[model samples]
Target: MSASAGSPGGAARSLRSLRDLYDQAVELPAEERERFVAALESAGSSHCAQLRRLLAAADPSAESPLDDDPWARVEEEEGPEPVPERIGPYRILSE
Candidate 1:
């Protein structure tokens, strides 16, 4: 599919924006980090669960061997989300 072929859902759009905001907010310290995390968690009610699962999967500390692949688990939970046909060499696996 082309770059413009699929459109992102509102939740995906919101998560992308929130990720950008988190990147910028990293500069702030103390209670700022807590507030930022809280706000993001609150704002992404619809997408936060899947986003959290993705985040955990991406984290090295959480890595563990499982009978089922993390990507498969993600697919089961998220169903599908708009992703480009290719993101460099990696494509989002879907059912």
Candidate 2:
């Protein structure tokens, strides 16, 4: 059956396990596969919280790399200002 269609009780949770799902997503590049796992874990409070926690542990920066990028580009174009603080668990502590 299709992955989505077959999601029975605890199935989504079981499927999110890296040990279980990683092989299925082998066609995905490493980075994308990691991100997909992250999203699933952050799906939260359910049975599959491990993936989200693993992603954070595996790559702290991956959680919000985009936030830093725009700020860096803005500075290169327009000079520096005080950086914003704390996007969730992250902090822009300096300019």
Candidate 3:
């Protein structure tokens, strides 16, 4: 059955379509991506701006959240922990 625009199924389909568009756009060379986005805009696709932003964020040269270790700063601020003197039956020696 076909989903109406306001239905949950319709929303899912729209999300799927956007994901598919993103996948396709991401695979294109950087130089060609602008043209692809422009084409979508010219076609009056509501997702064009969102797709452009997604493409920009996915660009290889763009800084990625994964590039930095989030915990690194916390670790630096906390510094290294001191070794415990003893544990249960064994005495702690070297770190």
Candidate 4:
């Protein structure tokens, strides 16, 4: 897409505008961030697509890396689940 495909500004101008916009947003209090973003969207924010994705990624509630982790993410992604547990009357209790 052009720097400012939908607006009168050129691509380079749009990049600079978005850079400044993000910088401003990051400077606001965290509590006010959502309101700031909402105000932008209500005013037909042009950078909604990028803002939405960045916000999702920045959400603290989102999943995070674990400490003392031994396995790789690829390992979990590629590994198969354990087999279903089975029970019988004679099942041994010893560990």
Candidate 5:
């Protein structure tokens, strides 16, 4: 039997489905996204409103976090670390 929305499993499944839908929606071109959401709404999808809100909040022009090198800032702020001449008992000869 299918789990009811009130059940924990059902809630988890609903969330996963919504997340998948949001991912799919975000991949569509901006011009086509409205029609994608409209189709969902016309079909009486439970996720229609939440999906719309997600799409509305998305900034297509914003740079993705992955596009930046996080280490670049650390290097700029702290500079490069000096190579160690020796460890506790061993000498660092190379690199």
Candidate 6:
């Protein structure tokens, strides 16, 4: 489930306290991100979903927000731009 999908599961809601810490850590140099993640994981960050959520929020490019149903309640978030198209190796062509 997504924030956009209104997922307020315990795991999602429970991570809010750690948000500020995560926000600070995520601002580490991009090259340091992996080490930071690894350190966190090694330091008993065992909850996979929670970790993924933090990492995903930290780096939006790490994953796609909506992989299906482009018309599924995204109107308020992104306006009415058409679903974007991938261009060449690394670009999106959108309205």
Separate clash counts for every candidate: 0, 1, 0, 1, 0, 0
TM-score for each model: 0.32, 0.26, 0.62, 0.51, 0.59, 0.38
Residue pairs clashing, model 5 = none
Which 10-residue window in model 2 sums to the lowest lDDT?
45-54
lDDT, candidate 4, residue 14?
A: 72
Between prediction 2 and prediction 4, which has the larger lDDT?
Answer: 4
Q: In TM-score terms, which candidate is top?
A: 3
Model 6: which residue pairs collide? none
Q: Flag regions of model 3 displaced more than 4 Å.
A: 64-95
* By lDDT: ranked, best first: 5, 3, 4, 6, 1, 2
Model 6, stretches more than 4 Å misplaced?
A: 1-17, 47-49, 57-95
lDDT of 4 at 21: 72
For TM-score, candidate 2 versus 4, the one ahead is 4
Across 27-58, the per-residue lDDT of candidate 5 in tens digits comes to: 99998888998998898889999998888879
The lDDT of each candidate is 0.60, 0.57, 0.88, 0.69, 0.89, 0.63
TM-score of 1: 0.32
Backbone clash total, candidate 3: 0
lDDT, candidate 4, residue 66?
A: 52
Give the TM-score ranking, best first: 3, 5, 4, 6, 1, 2
- Per-residue lDDT of model 4, residues 1-95, tens digit only: 65445576686677776777777777787788778788888999797667656666666677766533656665678796544444565554543
In angstroms, give how far residue 57 of model 1 lies from its true place: 0.5
| CA shift of 91, model 2, Å | 75
Tens digit of per-residue lDDT, candidate 3, span 1-95: 88975899998888898999999898888999899989988998878988988887877799877999988988899987788888888999988
Clashes of 2: 1
RMSD of each: 19.5, 14.7, 3.5, 10.1, 5.6, 16.5
lDDT of 1 by residue, 1-95 (tens): 43331456655666676576545555566446556556767876444455445544555555478645879889889888776777799876763
